[model samples]
Target: MNLLEYLNQNYLMLVPALWVLGFALKQTPAIPNWMIIWVLLFVSITVGSLTFGFSYEGLINGITAAGVAVLGHQMVKQALLGSGSRKK
Candidate 1:
């Protein structure tokens, strides 16, 4: 099942935006590794609310966007890194 189906079409753009923001956060010295997700979520929520007004659907879409961005990053990362087993 595509998790993205639950998100609004308008919110789809936010996924990539969040990903880029997360990447920037990772590169920053002050952000720290653990806080990156929270930062992304906060930005996503704010963006959603601003776009659609404050409401349950807006909040849910924000959450879904953040989730998709993080999940996509991790999936790609795992594919490239493998399961921690390297053959020399």
Candidate 2:
């Protein structure tokens, strides 16, 4: 089977897994927050392209996946911790 077919079939699993990874990265103190976001974006694009035979569609999907992850993380944090609380 081709990469697109595989991606279509497995995106449900893949996207969430990538999102969780981004969330975990956010918790690590070794890397800055901005760097974590960029890293996740880069990871999404690279992984998607490599897994799906490299295409514009793959790139777009990767970016979307990363955005979903980041947004989800922020939403969860805000909901659970309240917006007024700063981590620093």
Candidate 3:
């Protein structure tokens, strides 16, 4: 298989996995929403730039991915922790 095909295959798997991972990260102690968003955003952008060769959309895609990840993490966290309030 060619490099592009190999990358596309992995990207398909990774996108969903990243969502799961973002939620997992939320379970950790003191995992700020901002940090999670930034990290995921940076990773997605880096991947897009390297994989699809998006020159300008690199920043935009990165921001969008990060927002999506953060929102997903927040939803998962709320589901698990009950409206984001810490259980006493």
Query: Tell me, what's the RMSD of every candidate?
Result: 2.3, 6.2, 8.0
lDDT tens string, model 1, 1-88? Answer: 7989999999999999998999999999998899999999999999999988999999999999999999999999989999786777
Candidate rank order under TM-score? 1, 2, 3
Please list the residue runs of candidate 2 whose C-alpha ends up more than 4 Å from where it truly belongs after superposition: 1-10, 83-88
The TM-score between candidate 1 and the true structure equals 0.92
Question: Cα deviation in Å at residue 55, candidate 3?
Answer: 2.2
Cα lDDT tens digits for candidate 3, 1-88: 2222333333444456568767676687778865766667677778767866776655555555555555555667689988558666
What is the clash tally of candidate 1?
Answer: 0
TM-score of 2: 0.72
Better of 1 and 2 by TM-score: 1
Instruction: Look at candidate 1 and give me any clashing residue pairs.
Output: none
- Model 2 scores worst on lDDT over the 10 consecutive residues at 1-10
Highest TM-score, which number? 1
Candidate 3, residue 33: the lDDT equals 67
Candidate 2 residue-wise lDDT, 1-88, digit = tens: 2334333543445567877777688788888877987988898888878887688778777777777667777778789988579767
- Point out where model 3 deviates above 4 Å: 1-15, 20-36, 83-88
Q: Which parts of model 1 are misplaced by more than 4 Å? A: 84-88
lDDT (0 to 1) per candidate: 0.93, 0.72, 0.61
* lDDT measured at residue 68 in model 1 versus the true structure, 0 to 100: 96
